[model samples]
Target: MASELPMEEIVRRGARTNFEGLRESSFVPLFLTLWGRQASDDHVRQQLKRHYESVTDHLVGVYADFFESQGWDPRPPFTIRDFAVTLTALVEGLTVRWAVDPDAVPLEMRSVQSSMRVERQDDLDAGPWDLFGIVVLALIPSMTVPRIKRDSELWADHEDVRGLVRRLRETWESMVGLSPPAEAPDHTAPESADHCGAEPRRT
Candidate 1:
């Protein structure tokens, strides 16, 4: 099903859908509480652990498909598994923080405001799900870098991911009627730099 959509669209849709589920569902918190309290119960712990693993596995499969659709290989030094685990951890951790204190992080409020502006709506009308989606979007890029950098060769071919992120940010800016930021200078080394010396010279 994810194959039908562009990677960017798939990411946006997935983020929004999952964000909504997390925000509106009490079952998530209930389950987390149960896991925390029942950690010493082997049966309960095993069940919860399996459930979490299954969910992360499914996310890895989706990411694998997305990478394949873009002609990118989802394998070591960092694989879809790595991406999935990291992404899920970020989402879960942030959701807990937001649940505890919506304004615990100033970025959370800023993301909500940015999303509202993009939607051309007031905060009251935006709803918690919309704010959650905004937070996910804001967090995805930074989380992606570690996986991308793990294999420089693979990353070179998949550099489009960076551009895609930039475009997404620009889209939000345009929606909110703001000027896009100036492009930063490229500081990346040339392919041949690897052969030049042990360390590439700075430009």
Candidate 2:
């Protein structure tokens, strides 16, 4: 379900859905305890361990594809697999917390706001942001860079305009996981007879 959705929706719905499922499932605690016990149930423990590792590996692949599709490169000291592992851990921890105290990790918590600049009116109109979504949003900046191509217009603009445009586009990418549609035009392709921005040669 998460893989089919856009990044923004994944951040919102993905985390919430996982938390809700884990918190409500009676099998989660049962499995955890069963895996931890040192009784003679070694076979059961090995099966559970393999299952957990398999799930983690699947998540790693999904996340790697998602990040690559969005043209985001990981920052130094972190890899795509690392982000996947972190996300898995985050959901697991949140589930435990929610199981302990539902009120503390409610589906709609107002106190926690992501540091990312909230998208304009669209996000506001979507209704209240949840704690899970906010945490996912906050994690984006530190882990990825907007390595996508810039718009051609950015190259033609003044320095300040270029900077502002770049920053805005980066924020946009972080929020929606989209990149500029086209790359900046090549300026060195043997200047045209009627240079771009130059007076029209009165032919």
Candidate 3:
């Protein structure tokens, strides 16, 4: 994130920088003000509501495909945290690929809304499939998974992105000995049946 400058052009690269430095940047205030207003506005609130509902529906469809592929029944929808994490992972993955392949749509998308002109975002907003925004905004949800995973030690469970498959597999094998409650033997079931018929004659 740091850029080099010749000795003559001294930029203050330090711990406590000046407030004035941010003002020099073109899009900072523009994007913040715009996003601040839009995010809090009633219109934006309605839009966000609709978006969450639609994405929840989308989660259902995605899980349907998932279960179908595995020959398992579709379970209930994800918890909010799970849904958000899954969405972030998908989006961040898109951003990673977008960074490599600079297709016009992807290239125009910036990390923050203020990085570009509002008109530009609006223009790209309606463009074919919103390919840029779809992948760009999609990133918000997909990004935080690995961080939380690392903190919680759940990183070892995933093999797809981090390439920790071998480690994860070893850990899984190590922990696979215990049967779950549902699969564990229920001693009372058969014992109850045996005692039931015999004791019922006395009743």
Give the candidate number with the greatest TM-score. 2
How do the residues 58-143 of candidate 2 rate in per-residue lDDT, one tens digit apiece?
Answer: 98787777777766676545677777778777877778787788788767755544533235655333334567767877777656
Candidates 1 and 3 compared: the better one by lDDT is: 1
> Across residues 38-120, which tens digit of lDDT does each residue of candidate 1 receive?
76888888887798899988998887766656555643345667778767776676678777886753333443444443333
Instruction: Give all TM-scores, in the order shown.
Output: 0.52, 0.57, 0.27
Per-candidate clashes come to: 0, 0, 3
Q: Give me the runs in candidate 3 sitting further than 4 Å from their true place.
A: 1-36, 72-85, 92-203
Candidate 1 vs 2: which has more lDDT: 2
Task: Look at candidate 1 and give me any clashing residue pairs.
Answer: none
TM-score of 3: 0.27
* Candidate 3 per-residue lDDT over residues 66-182, each given as its tens digit: 333433331123233454445434443444454456473342224443432224332233222224333423332232233223453434324332344444445676699643346
Every candidate's CA RMSD: 12.7, 18.2, 19.9
Clash tally for model 3 = 3
**On a 0 to 100 scale, what is the lDDT of residue 79 in model 1?**
60
In candidate 2, stretches whose alpha carbon ends up further than 4 angstroms from where it belongs are: 1-7, 38-45, 111-127, 149-203
Instruction: Assess the local accuracy of residue 183 in candidate 3 as a C-alpha lDDT between 0 and 100.
Output: 68
> How large an RMSD does model 1 have?
12.7
